[model samples]
Target: MNVFVSEVRQLIDRHLPHYVQSLQAEPRLKEAMCYSLEAGGKRVRPLLLMAVLEAYGKPISIGLEAACAIEMVHTYSLIHDDLPAMDDDDYRRGQLTNHKMYDEATAILAGDALLTHSFGLIADAETTEMTAEIKVALISIFSKAIGAPGMVGGQLADMLAEKKSLTVDELAHIHRRKTGDLLTFSIVAGAYIAGVNKEDRLCLEQFGQELGLVFQIKDDILDVESDSETLGKPVGSDETNYKSTYPGLLGLDGAKKMLSYHHEQAKGYLHKLGLSDTILGEIADYLVERLH
Candidate 1:
């Protein structure tokens, strides 16, 4: 798993920035895009996509474009999430957020550029295996995953729920779309590229749902348990923002249990698909147990 992660990280680092630099856009805009994308994230979303390909015995090259596209979208979300109107954070991944490195307006535009370009990457991807039909299918589901019916809508719901009371179920509802939708896309996209049957794809989506819960719950736990040096961002930001979190709504111990429950549930779905011994399962454990 470590080798797999390192390889994917290297691939993204090698290609994503150069792709942006090759663009015929304003230089500053290009720089801003590269700046955020260069941050050394765990690359969880992209890894999930590629892992699905590996599980089906497909080469990573076949899904590299889609993997990179999802990373672009994920980076854009983080950039926007740290803006003044949002989380208002100054640091991310132990460095300055886009707004702090450049400015608010530039940060906003950088995010937009990444988001818009992501679809184009998938739609007109150079992947030899990606037919026009496959490209459209990828784009349709990709758009829906991050658009209004997914991440965007979830963001709005999160904003609305802030400072107000929320139950565990409500919090789950918001995050399922906000965080889970993109994850579901990652898994489903891989299955699509692998040409898996619909039955298997549905099982992966179920696993993605449970994994999403684990991701959010662990994030909530880290917000309380981790510090600035370790997390690369300020701790206690959830409480500072008065946003409902798993740890905040349920006690820390309760959140840990929820995290474990979902972690195990996620593995169960993989078991159903007989992927428990594969990289897919390993990544699930990584996401659940990751400290930062």
Candidate 2:
């Protein structure tokens, strides 16, 4: 891993689990929320936020609250996504899925708690420099990213696309919302916190779009080529669920090509933003090249 990524990951890992602990919520609920938060996935969303902050020469502390909020939303999505009514996965990050670790009801409540508290975390952020305007903007973008028009809407579309064929554009639409929007939010959030100009923020949004494609396409490739142990989740589950994927739609080689194309596009956007030599560049490479 890059030294910068390692540092940010460590910062997130150390603090993420504790946020839910101090909530005035039920003990079991907090335990379940903490259980999934600590499961230790890539932490990619938060990393993107902080990395973009660093790229803009802003303090990482300026974005930490929003980073955690983004992560909590992500983790909640995963927990709910693993429910029996959804993907029905037994494991994630090499541990039992939340529903399996505790129970379905507890898992549901835990996700809800995390999702609701995330906004509060940002609103009440202890960052002395953050203003009400920034908090409100973050909350607005965030709700849209993970809510009806974004992740949830995309998820519904994904489920409906199962066992059916879709064109490249159609598949992109689903992944754009289900996966891309939140990733875009992560980068854009940093730009907002960094007080970047409109043109620069636009550059980051474009960069994030390409990176999101790289991530989802690589994920599709991994499902076919990697193992359950390597992924820390079941392999070939996409096929089993009859979901449309870049690999399924374009074939493995074709998917690789798409991934490569997006990776390059992201680099172009970074160059456009004058961030080609920064940690954002490293993160872009890591996202597409990662094994899991």
Candidate 3:
């Protein structure tokens, strides 16, 4: 799994810059796009997509464009998420955030460009080896996952929930859309590319949902347990924003237990799929164990 992750990361690192460079727009916009895209992070979404592809005995290259597209959307979200009007953080991935490094307007535009460009990348006829039918399917999946009914809706719910106490169910609802939808898209996108049976695709989608819950739970735990330097962003931002989190709603230990439960659930679904490889299981473990 480590080897697979390393390979995907390397491919993403190369492809992201080249894709951005291919754009013939404003130089500053391009610069801001590259800046945020190149900023180091876990690259988890794309890796998950590729891992699923690898698991199904498909070439990782088949999913690379869609994987990169998902990363772009993820990166765009982070850029906007750190704006002065949003999370308002000064740092991300161990460096100044897009809005902090460039002006807020540039950051906003850069994020918008990335978001729209992601769709273009996925739709480009020459970009990937996938059939037009599959490309359209992926675009639909990608759109729904990040659009108003998905991540955007989740973000709004989260913002509205700030400073307000939320029940466990409410919090779960927010995380499922905000974080889980995109993660689920990542897995299911690869499953679609592999032309897996409907049953396997459903199992992978279920696994993705559980994996996303585990991700958010661990993230909440990390905010309280880790430092800003370790997290590469302000720790306790959730608290500062008066946002409800698993750790705040449940004790730290309780959050850990919840995380463990979701982790097991995710692995269970993965096992049910009965893939020939173990990358997806390893990815589930990595998501729970990751510190930042």
TM-score of 2: 0.97
- Pairs of residues at least 3 apart in sequence or in different chains that clash in candidate 1: none
Report the error of model 1 at residue 278, Å: 0.3
Poorly placed runs, candidate 3 (over 4 Å)? 125-129
Kindly report which residue stretches of model 2 are placed more than 4 angstroms away from their true locations once superposed. Answer: none
- For model 3, residues 85-140, the per-residue Cα lDDT tens digits are 88788888789999999999999999999999999988873634478988988898
Candidate 3 TM-score to native: 0.97
lDDT of 1 by residue, 129-165 (tens): 7989889988999999999999989988998898998
- How far residue 207's Cα lies from its native spot in candidate 3, in Å, is 0.5
lDDT of 3 at 208: 90
Give lDDT for model 1. Answer: 0.90
**Shift in Å, residue 203, candidate 2:** 1.4
lDDT of 2 by residue, 1-292 (tens): 3777788888888778888887787899999999999998788998899888888888898788888888999999999999999888888889999999999999999999989999999998877657898889888988998999999999899888889999999999999999999999999999999898899998899998888888899999999999888888779988887888899889899999999999999999998888899988998998887889
For candidate 2, the 10 contiguous residues with the lowest summed lDDT are: 1-10
